[model samples]
Target: MSDYICNWDHCKFEGTKNLAIRHVIITHAPPEKVPYFCTLCSFRATNLKAFERHLTTFRQHILLEKENSQTKEYLQISTESYNVTWGNRNCDLTLKNEKYLYPEPNIVPVLLEINEDYTVYNETIIESTASQTEENNENIEKLKTKHKREMNNLAEYIIRLEKKLSARDQEIFELKRELRCNEPFIQGFNEMWEDQVRDKKEQRDRKREDWRRGKVAKENMEPLGETFSSPPSKKMKSLVKKLF
Candidate 1:
């Protein structure tokens, strides 16, 4: 069989099909759509500024690789209790494909504080001052598990609230049809209301999915339960006042 030639941009990699695919995935095809995130809830949508600093560090690391910097050194400040290890060894920042950044939940990365100059890099470090403290990995895993459970509960609650809102919207449409209130103004109002609700629902759906996948941004995590609080009751009162 012929070798698989990777022609992605300036990449000159040639290998077997399996190797070529792996290279593409590890080198170029990280889910760039999903912003880089820590496995633990240590850095998430709630802490936008700090998480952004980590991203800045990621870019700096990529720049270093491009420049072919030799013997680069970085200080890793550990925010988590555990030390991150890569392939049975301490992580080398020069290696861009960090073991913890992968989504598999197999590794927990540590958080770092970046310096102000040199376009200094910040990241979640796994290898620590304790020299790869392997025992604390379980603590990271426990935190992640708890975080996932809480988020799932919140998502389910919001979904139930959305269902109630949808049902109320349907009742409004039925009332309009039953009253034969096809006045131009009424029709226009109904259309606008439908459009608004549709947009809101779509936005909520997208946010829910992103939250589930741990790819959500800051604003998307806002507490939506407040938006639905007694909305149905208030809408019912308004609907009656309008109908009469």
Candidate 2:
């Protein structure tokens, strides 16, 4: 990399050789300025490339060569000629000329009147904006209050539901406790009733067996008494013959 410095006395631009040359050629010593001169348009340039570019670029500029020593260059830049060539060009020069050189200079007084009107319009806009801002603030405050109230009501409703749930849970707990407390008593009562029923069944079965045995004994005694009565009858007959 070769370091190249600018040769211009006041220019401190420096870079690599190609970059510095381009910078100097393009920026500081442009082609329209120095050693390259165009005899046709009396335009000076630094290089042949610059001269060729200027010739191509400003081909619209007319250079009239007279038989005299001096050549006259005419730039057709007047407003009428620009309108004729470019068609209806609007320029600031015409407005400036109207404002400055006219006998009356109509724009400043009209601008003053507009400024006064704008001041009144701006005040009215500011007053309306202030009123709207105040109204918005009041509406926002009311909405905030409504939101807080609704949130508080929701919280209270939640609390009430929680309390009711707690009460229901307590009721369920008490019912379970009562069932547990009565379970042993209920079991004992059922066992006592079963024992009483078993004892009554055994007593009834013993009374039935005793009644059956008594019936059988009564039937056997009736048959034995008949057999004894036949023996007694023979004895009576023998005694009566002896007496006779």
Instruction: Tell me, by lDDT, which candidate is best.
Output: 1
lDDT score for residue 166 of model 1:
100
1-244: candidate 2 lDDT, tens digit per residue: 4344444344454455334433433343322322333444444433334444444444232122212212223211111110100011121112111222112122312110000111101111145545665676678779989999999999999999999999999999999999899999989999999999999999999999999999988876768656877666666778887888
- What is the per-residue lDDT of model 1 for residues 12-53, given as tens digits with 9 covering 90 to 100? 555554444334433443232112334422222212344445
Best by TM-score: 2
* Candidate 1 segments whose C-alpha is farther than 4 A from its true place: 1-135, 180-244
For candidate 1, the TM-score is 0.22
Task: Please give each candidate's TM-score.
Answer: 0.22, 0.28
| lDDT values for all models | 0.46, 0.45
Count of clashing residue pairs in every prediction: 5, 1
Deviation from native of the Cα of residue 56 in model 1, angstroms? 25
Give me the displacement of residue 71 in model 2, in angstroms: 68
